[model samples]
Target: MAGNSDPLTPRAKLAVTAGKAVAAASRAAGRGSGSVIGGRVALKLDPDLLARLAQNLDVVLVSATNGKTTTTRLIAEALRAAGPVVSNALGANMPAGITSALAGGSDAKYGVIEVDEKYLAGVARDTDPKCIALLNLSRDQLDRAAETRMLAENWREGLAGSKAVIVANADDPLVVWAASSSPNVIWVAAGQMWKDDAWSCPACGGVMQRPGDDWFCGECGFRRPTPTWALSGDHVLDPHGSAWPIHLQLPGRANKANAASSAAVAAVFGVPPQVALERMYQVQAVAGRYDVVQFQGRDLRLLLAKNPAGWLETFSLIDPPPTPVILSVNARGADGTDTSWLWDVDYTRLTGHPIFVIGDRKLDLAVRLEVANQHFQVCENLDQAVQMCPPGRIEVIANYTAFQDLRRRVGN
Candidate 1:
C-alpha cells in the first residue's frame, strides 16, 4: 500500500471487511472458514487470491476468445457431478468479479473460473492452478486487448515455469504453438470438416496455415494431432430441448469449438464422452450469452456481444433481417471505453426489421442498423425497449452493462 495515495482506496478494504462479516455469518450457520465469505476476504487481500487457493486444490482455469462462461459453467457442472465445486457463474471475468465469486462458495473441492485473456498472466502468476484451459484466440476487442499475439505472449511468459497442465485447442495455431514445448500438455483439436480460419502461426508468423484436413504450420511444419473427442453426427442436443442437426446451441461454427474445448476439460476431469455429451446437451446457454427467454409469450433471445468474435456469433444465430430484434450498446466505462470493434462485425447479415433499439450508444447501433437498410424505433432505456416491443419473436442484443440492465429488467 506504499504507492496507494487515494482516499478512495477504501474500496478494497471495505470489500474485505464485508467479506469477513459474511464469513463470520456463514460460520455461525455451521459452515467452515472455507465458505464463500472467508474465501472472498482472502481474495480481496491477495489480489491473486484464487491462485493461492489453487496451490492446495484442483484449480481449473478456462480462458478464451468466446464461450468462456458457458465452457466454465459446463466444466464446473460436470465436475460438480463428481463433488462440490465453485465458479464465477455471473460472467465477471475481471479480478474483482473473481474475488466476489470465490468469496461466495463453501466447501468446494474444485474451483473453476472463466478468466479474461487480458488478466490471464496476473491470475496465473497468483493462482498457479493445476489446470489451465485455453479455448481459442480470435480477433476480439482490439481496442481494449491488443491483437491476440499480445495475449499469447503474456500467456507464454506467465506460464513459462509453472507446473500447470495446459489444455489447448490444437486447431488454433496460437494455442498449439504456445504449448509446443511444454511436457504436460493436452491438445484437443476440432474434428475434420470443421472450418478453419487460422491465418498465421502466432509463434513464427510464417503463414501458419491449415490444410484441407487439419492444422499444419506452413513455416515450422508443426502439425497438431486430431482431437481425441469431437462432436460427431449431424445433430447436436441442448439442455433446453433445442436440437441442432449439424448445428449448435449458439448460432455459428465458433461455438462448436467452444463446446469441444469444454468437453476436453470434462474428459480430463474423468467425465465419459457419452455422459459429458448428455450433460452438455442439457445446457442451453448461460446468462448474457445467447440465453433464450420467454418474455410475455414471446421468444426473447439475450445475446452479449462484447467483442468481434462474440458479435459474429450473434450474427450467425439468426437467419436474416426482419427477425424483430432489440439491440443495445453501452459506452460506459464498465463496458470498455472503445467501441471500434463494432466495425469488425458483419452487421450486413441483418436483413430483418428490428422493433426497438436502446442504449447509451443507441445512435451507434442505429447507424449500423440504418446502413444495413433497416430502421428501428429508438428508446431511451432498455426497460422501455423491452416493453415497447410487440409480444412476439424478439431478440435482445447488448454489451456488458446494457445486458446487466436488460437482465434486471427482464428478471433473468
Candidate 2:
C-alpha cells in the first residue's frame, strides 16, 4: 500500500467483508453465480464502496447493444498479457455485478468491466476509469431500457467532462454521437450491421446520409469521425497504418469486429496491438457464447442473439440451409419482455434451414416465421426440440435467458 494515501475506509471494509460472506453463502447454496447479489449487498452497506474499491485500480468499462460480454472478455484477456486483470466474466454488467467483480479481484491492478448501456453513465461516474469503449447500439430490451438515441444522449451528458480516453466504434453513428463529446477519443472503424436504429441523427433528427462506410448528418453537421483504427476485411489496421491479421478462436465476422475494438482499448492500457491480438486469439468462447457442447449424441453449438441487431449478426455465424437450426425465444424480464423485436428481424434469412422453434415464446416466434413465409415446427422445450431434429450437429440460437437455460442443462 506504499504511495497510496487513501486505503479502504472502515465502512467500505465492513461492506466488502459483509458482501464476500453473502457471496460465499450464495455460491454454496447453488442458486446462482452470486455476482449481482454480493455486489448489491456491498452497495447497500456503503453507497461509496464501489468507488473506494476501484480507487487504486485502472478501470476500463465496455458498453454496447451487443457484444458487451465478449468485448469485455477480449479486452481483459489482452490486458492480462501485461498484468493481472479482473473482470465480470459471468456476463454481469450492472453496478451490483461490477462491484462484486471489483471486490473479488483485490489483488489485480487492472479491471475491465462490462456495463449495461443504461448503467454506463453511473459506473463511469463511480469508477473514474482510464478508458471506455462504446460499441454499436441498436434497439434492445425496449420495454426495460431506453431507446438507443436516449442512451446516446445520456452517454453524452454523463461523459461530458471526463478525462478518460474513449475507444469508440466510428462505424456506429449512435456510438459516435455519444463519444464525440469526450476530450480524448480514439475512433475505430469496426463496421455496423444494423442501420435501422441510426437512420435519424441523435443530435438534430436530420436524416443520416451514408456513403459507403462513412455516415453524416446534413442538418446539424453531426458526422462519423475519421478513424485512426479500422477493420479492412480480414485484418485490423492500427493507428500507425500497420495491418494485423486477426486469428481468433472466437467465431464470426462480428467477433472479429469486436476484437478490433478490444485491441484499441487494450492499447490505451499499455498493451500493444500485437500483444493484444495475440492474447485475444486464446479466448475460445465467451460465457458459453459460440461454445459447442456435445450433448445427447450431437454437437450443440450455442449462441445468443437477443434482439434484431444481434439476430442480424447471428444469422451469418450459423451453418447454411440444410443445417438444423433451433431458434429459442424467451420474453422473460432478462430477455427484454417484448417479443415484438422478433418481427424486426428478417426471419426469411433462416428459411432454407430446418427450423425448430423452442422456449416459452415459441408461439410468438412461430407467428413471425409464418409471416415471413418460412416453415417451422414449434416445440415446448429444448430437449423435445433437439430430439425432433436429426442429430449430427445442430445450431442453437437463443435469446438471453434461453441461452443461459440451455447452457445449464446441456453445457454443464
Candidate 3:
C-alpha cells in the first residue's frame, strides 16, 4: 500500500515545510533538479508513499537511448493539442522527476514522461503506464546502463506479461522483433534512406543485411516487414529546403528521426498525419540539441553529443568552419558518472581538429583530438577555455552534460 499521510494535510505541515526548504535550496544552488532530487531521496526511503501519490493516473512511459527528451516533449505537445497534458519538461527522466510531475496533478488526463533506459523497468513496475512508447535501442550511456544488449534484455523481461499498448520502432529490427509477441504492438518505421543506422538484429545477436530499406538477419531469419507508419523521401524535407516545404527548425538526421517517431505516435492517437505534420512543421527547435544561437556576431551551433551514436549523427550534419573550434567535455557526478562511452564515439570524423579543447578534463579530450593530427589549445579550467577561445568566431561542440556548463561559462 502507498503512504497514508496527506502531504498537504495540516498534520504533515512539517513535510511540506521541508519540501519547500529543499526546493529553495535547490534554486539557490542553480540546479533544476533541486527539490525534485531531494524528493527522490525521500520517496525512495518510503516506497509506499510514492505509490500512494501515483494512485489513479494513466502513465505514458517513453524510453529510448536517443530522442527521449524530444519525443517526450512532442508527445506531450500532441496530447495537449488534443486536450490536456502533464509532464516533466526539464529532462528529468528519473523516478523522482516522474513522481514530482505526478505528485499533485490528480486531474491529469495524460501523464507523459521520458524515462531513462536503465530505470524503465522500475518506473514501469511502479506506474504501470497504459501506453509505453519504446523508441529505437542504441548504444547510449554505456557506463551506467551497461551494454545495449543488456538494457534490451532488461526491457524484455520488464515488460513481459504486461498488457501495455507497446509502441515499438519498426525500422529498428531490434525493437520490432522484441515486441513481436506482445498483444498490442504499433510498429513505426523510418522513411529516410540516408537515415540508415539500424545495423543489427536484437534477437539471436546476428548481423543484419539491409535489402532495400528493410533489414533481414540472414543467420537468425528475422526481418522487419513494411511498417504501419513510414516516413520516406520527399515526405522528409531537408532542414534548409523541402519539396513539401517543411521548415523544420531543428537540424541533423537524428532530429528528423525524432520528428518521424513523434508524428507516428501522434497519428496513433488519432491526430491526422497532415495535422501532425503541420504541428511538427510549426514546432520550435529543441532547446539544446543542435540549437543554433548567435554569439558575438557569429552563428553558434550548440550540438549535444550525449552518446557515441548521437555524436555520429551530429558529425554527419556538421560542416565545420575554417575558424578554430571550442570543444567542452566534462562528466560531473550529476551530468553522468560514466565517461567510458567516449571510446565508442567516432572522434575520427572530426578530421581537422580546431585550435581549442576546453573542459574540466581538457587533457583527456586533447588526447582524443590528437588522433586528428591537428594542434590544439587545452584549457583545463572552463573559465580559461572561454578566455582562450578566439574572440572573433568560434564553433562549440559539447556532450550531454557539458551543454549547460558551456552555456553558463560563455554567458550564452
**Which one is best on lDDT?**
2
Give the best candidate by TM-score. Answer: 2
Off by over 4 Å in 3: 1-21, 29-31, 41-56, 104-107, 191-201, 234-247, 281-287, 294-298, 334-340, 352-355, 380-393
Model 3, range 1-412, lDDT digits (tens) per residue? 1223334434233443455467668878887657476556546545544454454555677888777887787777766666566777667778777766665455566677888888888887887677788877766554555666667778888888777788777776656755675687766665332223356567876778887767788888888765565445426332222323233566656666666666666655666555656666555655555556665555666777776666677677766645556777777765466666566666666666455776666677777767756578887655555566665545577876688876665465
* Candidate 1 structure, TM-score to reference: 0.78
Q: After superposition, how far is residue 383 of candidate 1 from its true place, in Å?
A: 5.4
* Model 2 ranges with Cα > 4 A deviation: 1-5
Every candidate's CA RMSD: 7.9, 1.4, 5.0
Q: What's the TM-score of every candidate structure? A: 0.78, 0.97, 0.82
Write model 2 residue lDDT over 231-271, tens digit each, in one string. Answer: 88878999999998898998889999999999899888788
How far off is residue 201 in model 3, in Å? 4.1
- Per-residue CA lDDT of model 1 for 1-412, tens digit only, reads 1122232235544555666677678768865432455555656565544543344446788887767888887778667766677788866776656665654544566778889888887777766677888877776644576677777777777777678788787666667666664567776654322123356666666675555656666777767755544444443333233433433455556556666666567666677544555566556778656677776656788888777667766766664556677878887776677776666666766655565778888888777767767657899876676677755677787888888888877778
User: How far out, in Å, is residue 342 in model 2?
Assistant: 0.7
Query: What's the CA error at residue 16 for candidate 3, in Å?
Result: 7.5
lDDT of each: 0.66, 0.89, 0.65
Between which residue pairs do clashes occur in model 2?
A: none
**Candidate scoring better on lDDT of 2 and 3:** 2
Using alpha carbons, what is the TM-score of model 2? 0.97
Model 1, C-alpha of 16: deviation from truth (Å): 7.5
